[model samples]
Target: MATAAQKPLTGAKVFLMLVAFFGLVIGVNVTMMKLAIATLPGTEVDSAYSASLAYEKEIMAAREQAARKWQVEARIQRQGDGGAVVQLEARDANGRPMTGLTFKGTLERPIDKRADLPVELSEVGIGIYRGSASAVAPGQWDLVIEADARGQRMFQSRNRVILN
Candidate 1:
């Protein structure tokens, strides 16, 4: 029996194969780089030096805040339109309602800081604050609540919350 011979391998075929392989590799690398850059969250602090300098002050402030023994509670409820309703209650060490405080609430995304939403809370009842934020996507979030009195921060708390 006679058999036909296969075509000889040529330099052009080898070069083309190499080019196609490298092109695919480079294309995938470029796509991955773009995704990484787009999803990256910038530095937590603008300047490391400034943050370091304020570390001591932050510690002192935290100690003072803890010493106050303020009882603060925060609640978040998911809305129908991808928003959230925020409610907060505060009390002093003696269980009396903490009054005359300005409250600010923030819903921070765990992975993406850009998705953070700030809620402007207002006092409806004494020590009872309520606010809402629009365009809040559902998922895990860090609820940060801060209370201020006389232009000074008096209480602060951070809690993890899930919105379905």
Candidate 2:
């Protein structure tokens, strides 16, 4: 007896398979996108163009600052409690300790907006300044140190620190 002719796969079946595969891929992509948006902090800058516009002026100011040749060294260490301390030493190009300068500092958590801490350093000695913050969580943090000598000498530096 002769068997009936069998029908091969049709175009509709192939098209449906392609659609399902792509639909799965698209579904996964959307899920990941949602999770990223929900967990991560958004917006590094409110106005990039404005910042770029000031780039030239900032460069000039930096050059003016560099001409003074002030050296600033910064350090961060953990305290006995759940806090951290920052120390800074400033010197002129002549390697003499800097004195009688106004200093400011800040500690910022990169991911948490509310974890910002203002630093107030007291001069322990000439060119030596130190400050402490309480209730600092154990993680990586950003530090900005600034020192100004009247209206003349200006110095600013940024560094990253970790607390345990």
Best by TM-score: 1
Alpha-carbon RMSD, each predicted model = 1.6, 4.8
Runs of candidate 1 with Cα error greater than 4 angstroms are: none
Over 4 Å off, model 2: 1-40, 151-153
lDDT of 2 by residue, 25-141 (tens): 999999999998887766667799999998898788789879989888888888788778888888899999988888888888888756789989989998899998888888888
Q: What are the models' TM-scores? A: 0.91, 0.69
Instruction: Write the residue-wise lDDT of candidate 1 on 1-164 in tens digits.
Output: 88899898899999999999999999999999999998898878899999999999889989999899988888888888888999888999999998779999998988888888999999999989999999887789999998889999887788999888
Q: What is the lDDT of residue 25 in candidate 1?
A: 100
User: Model-by-model lDDT, in order?
Assistant: 0.90, 0.84
- Model 2, residue 148: distance off in Å is 2.5
